[model samples]
Target: MSSCHKCWHCITKRTRKDATRIVDVKQTKELSSPGAVEVDSPIGLLASTTAAFLGRARRGPLNTPVFIENFSEFRDHFGGCWSGSMLADAVQQFFSHGGTNLYVVRIANNARGARIDLPGPNGPLVLEAAEPSSTEHVRAAVDYDGIEDEKGQYFNLTLQRLAPDSSIVLDQEIYRRLSCQSDNVLFVGSELARSQLAHVCNTVPAHRPDSTGAGYINQTEMGTDGSALSDYDLIGSPELGTGMFSLNKIEEFDLLYIAPSMTSCVPGPAAVLAAEIYCRRRGTMLILDPPETWMSTSDALEGFEEAGYAHPDVLSYFPRAMSSHSATREESIAIGGAIAGLLCKLDRQSGPWEDLDQQGFELSHDLLPALDIPASEAHRLVKGGLNVIVGQRPGHAMVCGSVTLAHGSQSGDQFTSLTTRRLCLSIKNAVDSVTRRTVFKLNTAAVKEHIVADVRKYMDELVNAGALKNDRFSVDCDTNQGEKRINCTRDITISLTFDPACSDETIKLNICQAKSDSEVASQYA
Candidate 1:
């Protein structure tokens, strides 16, 4: 497709100014032929060939130069070929070359393997295979306290570590198992867990001096004999009172077995709040095992509502109206958990959260009827009309304004006037849908043409009544978008004095345009 000069030429040209020797040979024969032979070894050709081979090899697998930092050693061992061992060697070499992190791909085959050794200073180290089938499994193995035995039952409180050699095997198994599931599980975590779990699982097969021929099936019985459960089997954070209080990490397991002596130390309200927030943000499910009571129904409902509404950016565009219903504290907590999970699932099913927000706004017009609010009001509320009373002290408070709308139309003819009315109604409906209220009426054509004149008259009336000392208001209109739309903008200020015992006063303003004889309201439904 496209060709460019090689780096060698550039480097040579740049260095020639500081160096003594500079030659431009058109052909290899000029330097190597009998009459002008400069050197006999052809070392440059060998170096060029080697460099070219290395360049091609780099792109062929992984495409990471760090992976093959020990190129000579790798070439000698795997001969620069593409193989699992070659990849492994490359990875190891990469790490050896001060590369601390890397991801390895393990293909399922008879020869596939990984080597691991406990961190140490000595050269000789013990190595073994890591066998894990999924990220969940890997997490369980790494975080939980046991292993699945030959009998398909988990041995709780067991301590285990994966051997380096088995790391790749575990990674491959984990990838294979999880690749079949649609859930968004982290691959790296899954592989690591799988390897550790496999190691623990294989402990019985490997046999230890402490093993009583009875095996893991009888390990529980040993616990009754005053043996420490943690010593013989593995248990996750929950059993140890350190598990996630809101969502259990081990809920991913199909069948979880806990020791009779195990006790759950559920999280507190703060934990529940954090978990709910995390789940809501991630759009994933957090399964809590040995469920614990956290926030009461009222507290949960209040918290969710407060949180939901406070973030207008999110609530304004949320596709569904969020509400809570709980008869009991437990039920409320359960509902809260469910809501968190459902939101995450919905988010994933739809798309990214931001995309969902945009799409939600587009679909929100249909939800006004269910909310028992006018479509226009709902639209305005969402655009920013309604403000949640966060901390309203006696005379002072905070309030936010809603989205503003301004439009103008030309009276071309009967048909054109009718079209303008319909458009205005549409705007009204959209605003009503967001605010859940209606607050405007259409004005006569004579009044519409001179809105500023009417405002001035109102201000004069207020001043004459001693209700206004100084009128401060502004109005302006513009024709833009190729003069197809006229935008009317306005700002108003009013001051009032009320009786000492009366609560704060709020005034409502309604504005509309007059309609021609041909204008008619169209059915919004």
Candidate 2:
């Protein structure tokens, strides 16, 4: 448990990253950064970057999940891990595209941690950063101010995590009244066990560490950021919680975009399959980027059909978005971030049921599609269940097509439209939220009625907001659908099946109450 004191600097030409005692350097008081929007259960990402700690720790008693609150805070901590890291660009694309509800998992190959050695009465005292990084500017200071220790064996320690290229502190922690003896009540080892910054590397010295904040101190040693990520790095072990599996920490996610593992606009086939299955398990959508082989419209169509890349819970966009590297050259980048953000904006501004077919749904950042698609090609791509970028004006482009990878389902074309899937997810989220609060109540007639009434009110709200058909949805609770009695005494479970607007098939969802243990709550009927 550490204090999250943020300064919220503008990050413009004149601002810096600082807050609290360290932020007094910049004197920033309020948060007014543009594109800093807030929403619940935002889009999740798997990024390759360096940090004080990327929150991708091994399973143990001291495991901490790094849940990002907003875009600005993400920039402050993961803005610059190493020189070539894409943490900033990926997040900025999401912002420019208008997505929220973010969770990040930092990955490394053979990374090493930064540490500092201090002078102690008996031996040397060592403290190391929680996560490995070559570019994280971290340091520590020791002070013995007003200690209640009668033997003068207590001292204060301050750890500061600075920006990648500046002196502005991004995170700072102060541990006071810590004793050097292992048997003491306030032992340094036990005190720093809950620290978010650094941990005691070795056993505490026999006596208190000397004061190093005033005089010259042996500063922290720089560690290596290791090499680029591999395919297995992204699809980490499910049990250990690495790579895409790290998302187990987040309860609910609306959209997911897996950044490139090897090169631009591509992840391994095995990784894509793993992510699709994982997204299905979590009851969400995966925004896939075009494979490197799809350089043109005809190629994309042929490649998408030939490859076994069709799933109801997975959606994709075509060609790529041309990002300006300079005034002269523009490189083709994947549209996963932009497409995810556009969907997020659509889900918020319009209803999740509303697709970005028309009505001024535009992509920001002077972006243009990589290949020009004629009307005939666009129609064919839409039939193949892939979206496209159209209207290549200079400053921006339009998200013209909205289709899911699902060509057709057994019940008809309900999952064909991306909006239909989103609408169903929104309803699922609403049910889970309401049922969680009602789960602990006794099972009575009034309680069951109250549950049904709450769900119906939610469905009606979606209808009022132009998200659902007028009379196409229904809710059933505490009743047996099959032989099983809809049984749950200590747990809460709700089974639902409804039709989306202008859809032929019914959407079936069996959502269990969300728990903090990363339990599988949603299943297909």
Candidate 3:
């Protein structure tokens, strides 16, 4: 949003000045250390969805999270995307692979919105699209309808956000009893301020806009989709809250992903590192895609080491899938969405704590691995922190490895397994959610007990669901937490130890996520 940033956008394609080292090694190691945990309370405040996606789209507002319950909703919202658009593919694959709840945040790469002009008595009334995109088509209509103003002082206006195919109205706004006079309460600008489709721009005409024929079918000036996404566009500035940072506005999500593959063109190294850090901070997992450079197994191993991407919170795989692109043509595509969907299905059928290896996780669509990775090669990739998709026949492809990007002395043994890491995240989210309910309550003796009992109850609930091993956990709290209690700080630490049903090791946690007063704890048990 600064002048310098504005110039960065002027470039047709952004290239990383320092690609060899995208992140500070020392800082990354310190952050990834097992001892470091994102303990901020506000980050744990929302009810989380199964997953979320941020990427380039042919439509929708930039950096705004749109919750999608199904694929139909996605199609209806982001209508008429370019053929083979990464976002559209990912969403379609997600539903095909059994994912139910999702949040999509569309990102703009210096795009512009379409504008329209309505004929008015003195001049033209201008209106602009609320969200920029070539596919952001809107139609407006002005009619006298029920107006009694014979002098044509007032007119009814109808606005519709139409799909690119112009077959459906995604959204519609209707305004009645309106006048073009600025002094009138029904002025176009005043009423348009509340419109979702379009808003009035420039100046208001002295009289109402001339009526369009029939209904909301008046066309607007075509918009420009702009250029493809760049690494700068995806990483976005945290201060400006663009790109992944805009996710902070959302209540909650478990996993984050980019629809486009993690190639040098889109996500690249810089974006991947930024996403990993953000995911760790949010207690979520970043479903990293195979870099486009990984055309083969050997290249993937060498590339993995060179990239220095050993974060335990990042999950990645290699050897893209050969998906049917057209009736006679096939194209290679990243399988990140399929993996995320597999995780979602597993999370529901069993739980996030369920061991993925034993789950027999398979790709849903008729997808075949671009490379036929042998068992030995697959094992090597797994050891190197890269998963693989194995298929002997069409529609029989299955993921081979269920590991995080924590390889060789990362010392994050606790998170090496995807199941264990997810178990910890699930436990953390559960504890935070349960404790947050006590935020507004008085920090009294009974309230303190309520906090402890509530958390204990949740742990018990997890045990009942077979996600955790049966164990009695203790909640550590200050004897007094009301008006005046030890430094008068409304903070209490809770410690619990448990074993995850899907994990082989016993886990211990000291959850101190604070707001008002509460002691929350979780462990593998």
Predicted structure with the largest lDDT when compared to the true one: 3
Judged by whole-model lDDT over C-alpha atoms, candidate 2 comes out at 0.61
Order by lDDT, highest first: 3, 2, 1
Candidate 3, which segments miss by more than 4 Å at Cα? 1-49, 144-154, 162-171, 179-184, 203-208, 211-217, 236-241, 261-266, 324-330, 408-411, 461-466, 469-475, 478-489, 516-525
TM-score, prediction 1: 0.18
Backbone clashes in candidate 3 total: 5
Tens-place lDDT per residue, model 3, 1-525, is 112211211222211111121221111111233323322133221232478888877766667677777777776556534552578778878878888878787787777778888876688888888777776778788888766777778777777776666567656666776777788867778777766577787777787777786855455587777777777788888778788877877655788888772223347788888898788767789988776656778999898788888887888887877763334223567777777888888777777877555535677647777778888889899888887788756667787677888775354677778777887788776775545434334434555565566667667777787877666555544433433323323445555678777677877765553333333222211
Candidate 2 displacement at residue 253 in angstroms: 2.7
TM-score of 3: 0.78
After the best TM-score superposition of candidate 2, give how far the Cα of residue 308 lies from its true spot, in angstroms.
3.0
* Position 20, candidate 2: lDDT: 22
Candidate 2 per-residue lDDT over residues 105-213, each given as its tens digit = 6676667667788887787788877667666556777887766668988787777766666777666767666778788777888877766566788877888888886
Give the best candidate by TM-score. Answer: 3
Task: Compose the digit string of candidate 1's lDDT tens values, residues 1-525.
Answer: 111212111111110011112122111122122222121221110010000001112111111112222345334222343321223332332333223221111212122112322211222122223321111111111111233335322111222222222432222111111111123242222223433222222112211122112222111111001222231122113343222211231111110111111112322334334433433332222222122221222332333344432221111111112112322222211111122222233223431111212222111111111122334443444333131111112222111121111111121121111112222222222222221111111222322234334344544443343333334433221111122111222111111221111112222222222112322111111
Q: Scored by CA lDDT, what does every candidate get?
A: 0.22, 0.61, 0.68
